[model samples]
Target: MTGVPASAAGGTGRTVPRGKLGTAAVNQASLWNIANILTMVRLVLVPAFVVLLLQDGGHDPVWRAWAWAAFAVAMITDVFDGHLARAYNLVTDFGKIADPIADKAIMAAGLICLSSLGDLPWWVTGVILFRELGITLMRFWVIRHGVIPASRGGKMKTLAQGTAVGMYVLVLTGPLATFRFWVMTVAVVLTVVTGLDYVRQAVVLRRRGLAAERADAAAKAGQRA
Candidate 1:
């Protein structure tokens, strides 16, 4: 793209085989993509997921079913959007911000609503939410230094949390109830542990950044002298 012809030929994706045209096409292309569209759709469903989950307090199986369906679909979108973006080279700055927000918003709505219905413990939901928010904030806090990449533990945490919350949303009875409880316990543990790990990394990164800045400053001072 850096040296592509200015107006050579038509192309399908982000580039069009031309310089200015390709840049313009890519810039315009950011506005619409399968991944971003899915993300936006997920965000739009948060209210529905919340309202339906709360409507019957999850006592009505039908309402719970609908809520669970919505939550599941939204969660699926969360997984797909990232994969789609990366696979298709459709990643955008907007995607980087919106994807995580959409993920947390859906999860938050589910956890809070489920807890409100007494299906989940308020304290448990609170802890998970706190961890998620803290790490997200830490991400922005240290982003100038570097990005904290995703980890396997983080993926497991999301899976467990989603499974537990989905089961609770469905108001599953009998042995499934116990299973949900255990999954949630695991999720809570991972959430806290991974969150602490992120905090520790952030501290290390901030220190490194400060050291680099100071070193550069001292180098400049020595040169001046």
Candidate 2:
């Protein structure tokens, strides 16, 4: 029938494909955007930082100091990537997912390494790690429900932890001998409090389920009408 129409059945079936070369180019550019590249760089540096910290069985103060410096640089990158993503309009799903993962990995590595050195107590590290792990699991469980944006307290907690870690490292360098203990004590308090705050927020969100429920109800109503 009419030469078996070019697109009938399997004859080339060229129906002006949905994706164009230009669209593909845009997607590739987005994938390699500045924010995502920075995140990847952070991820790559984590293992190196860990290696530096663990290389010398905790004896050499010089190695310890350098390790601390590496950790600090990595943490700074953590802050920079987020700020750049937002300011330059380069935020992406990839950044959102990997940024926190990178933070947790670096923190966990530091805590574990320092704990092994007796600079940090096991119980203290245990508490912090437990909170971090617990909250992360809770987030995943409730991810389908709704987004739970970060609180001001959470941000404060991060700042406190970073400051405490830096100070603790400096103490190892023999600079702030007298005040180091006090600094760490304050850091521990902030960490525990912030962790509890996150748990409380998660519980509240679970009880309400307001955002997800509202969206679902709206969709059903539209379908019926």
Candidate 3:
């Protein structure tokens, strides 16, 4: 009927509870959001990239370059997804949790593969992978208290690693071999610096008792309320 609200309609033309449609709309919005979808896409690409890298044909310089290019694209998606989420106010808990995991997995797998192929030094990969895993575990440990936001140094570390790995792959070409080594060396230095910075931040947080202090303050305010 012309008088019926848009949310209500049926064969019998009966009116439904208005709140149901509103809740459904909210649920649908939450489920199909851009940020969460991008996170899932990133996670899916990790395994595909790994498979491509592991295949025997992947040893060819051309194939390796393509694989690395695919990886770089995936990594770029990681950057853009976060930027879009924050810039457009599309952030979600799903994104926050999955994005870092996807990043660590992709980078770790790539490094491991490169190491196995004897293309990169194991020690360098080991140091970076260990730091990534350690920080990820720390995030889980502190997640109950609150999120530790990504620091500027941490972001720079990611950029450095990506650039280094990309250059390393490009260096597979005979002409660029020496340049790749230098790029990788720079990346390794950045990785160590950023890792230490994260450790320092954790120590500062503990010393200030920021999370506990905030919790206590919240409780006291609640009591007063």
Q: Please provide, for model 2 over 1-225, each residue's C-alpha lDDT reduced to its tens digit, 9 standing for 90 to 100.
A: 223334642467543333453455566687678778877877877788767766667656677677788878878888888888899888777888898998888888878877887878888789878888888898987777666787887777777777776666543435565466667677678778877887788788876786678888999999999
Q: Output the number of the TM-score-best candidate.
A: 1
Model 1 error, position 221 (Å): 1.3
lDDT of 3 by residue, 1-225 (tens): 324454454545566566775666676687557777877887887887777776674476666767787788778888888888888877767777788888887788788878887888999899998888887777666655456788887887888788777666543566577777777787778788877777766766665676678889999999999
Give candidate 1 misplaced runs (Cα > 4 Å): 1-18
How many clashes (backbone N, Cα, C below 3 Å) per candidate? 0, 0, 0
Q: What is the Cα-based TM-score of model 3?
A: 0.79
C-alpha lDDT values of all predictions: 0.87, 0.75, 0.76
Where in model 3 is the C-alpha error above 4 Å? 1-24, 144-146, 210-225
Angstrom error at residue 201, model 3? 1.2
Q: How many backbone clashes does candidate 3 have?
A: 0
